[model samples]
Target: MEGTIKKLGQTEIYRGSRVHLVTETIQFPNGKRAEWELIQHPGAAAVIPVDADGKIIMVRQYRNATDGWTLEIPAGCLDHPGEDPLECACRELEEETGHQAKKMDFLYKFYSSIGICDEIIHIYVARDLVKTEQSLDEDEFVTVEHHSLDALLEMCFQGVIMDNKTISALLAYRYKYKL
Candidate 1:
């Protein structure tokens, strides 16, 4: 089948360090046209750092959008265009959790918010980690937390972990490996 929607043009409304806002003019297959506002993102990578005892290292931080704290897997956007996702994951793991992974296994990648944003999140499981010093960004204030895989699975089920990427990665890891 042919592509369903054709993008006629896009106008930039705003641009920020992490995301940009734009209005896109699209023509539907039914010959109808509409303008849609969307946030464009550079994409990101997240890592689930698992220690030798099988505890996953997580990060807790306050989110401005949510106006509250969130527990999530260590994640960050690609430093520049064409940066490898695995590299980003490894860097983020060490920066957020002070653990460098000796074994990085990619789990999956998906569009976290396909409706209003074009952000793709790559997920990985990091193991055989070595202790290191955390190198958080100047603006980042993250606290490291560790928990068992089963505990995280329960948190996901109980809606305690609300971050989409964290939930997705946890569920995917749990079922993918039959944990």
Candidate 2:
């Protein structure tokens, strides 16, 4: 379906460390034209780390976007453009949770916002983990916690888990493991 649209041009709106904003003009298959505001991102990766005891490692961090602390799976943006998301997931899991997994598997990838943003977040499942020291970014303040899958499902049911990527990743984990 995307092949039906032809890009006309794009006007730069803003550029930042993480994202670039632009208004893109396009001509539809029907000859209609429109302008759409798009957010260009370098993408990101997240991991659901499960330990030997079957507890999932999670992170508690403050998000200015929500004006509060959020409980989410360990995640981080790609180091730079053209970086491997799998490597980002592996790096973020250890950096945030202080645990490195011996068995890491790809779960899925998703668009953060379909309408306006081009951010893609790759999700993974990490098991057989061994504890290491957490290496956080200067701007990051994260507290690592562990939870049972049942407890995480309850958090989602009660709306406590609000991050979309975390929610979807949890659901996928449940489906994958038949839990």
Candidate 3:
């Protein structure tokens, strides 16, 4: 198990601000060899901001990859390498939603797309929100909205919420609070 796949070599395909693509040659357990293309990412943090009224703050933004607008929790990539995930969550919540959390609790961490990408997302539940000024990146255009937890759960089941991180965070929050 320890050496199930022996990495023979890897070639860098491309490196971008958020991801690094590479092709690797590996010898399988049965002595078969194959090449695999992998995407390396710096990871990210997402926050489910719940206000005192039990409504969750969400962001709607255009995603070029999907060619549509997506409803998701406030999230951002680990822009500063080696920065704390919780700090990133707080920053993203405020920057994207114009809200600051007085308390943030870690919910879960998972790979966004494990098949070919090595990007792990750390999710947190942010409570006791305070209104603040929103500060988004120059290229970012987002609309902040709030919905009840139950409504969001219904949206998840109805295919309204398509973002994986948003779905995961909402389900985790439901389980955590028995909602």
Which has the higher TM-score value, candidate number 1 or candidate number 2?
A: 2
lDDT of 2: 0.94
lDDT by residue for model 1 (16-97), tens: 9989999999999889999999999989999989899989999999999889999999999998878999999999999999
The TM-score values for the models, in the order shown, are 0.96, 0.97, 0.95
> Which lDDT value does model 3 have at 72?
90
- List, in order, the clash count of every candidate structure: 0, 0, 0
> Order of candidates by TM-score, top first?
2, 1, 3
Highest TM-score: give the candidate number: 2
**Tens digit of lDDT per residue, candidate 2, span 60-159?**
9999999999999999999999999989999999899898989999999999999999999999999999999999999999998899989998998898
The stretch of ten residues in a row with the least summed lDDT in candidate 2 is: 1-10
TM-score of 2: 0.97
RMSD of 2: 1.2
What are the per-residue Cα lDDT tens digits for candidate 3 across 48-89?
Answer: 999889899999999998999988999999986788999899
Give the best candidate by lDDT: 2
- Give RMSD to native, each candidate: 1.3, 1.2, 1.3
* TM-score of model number 3: 0.95
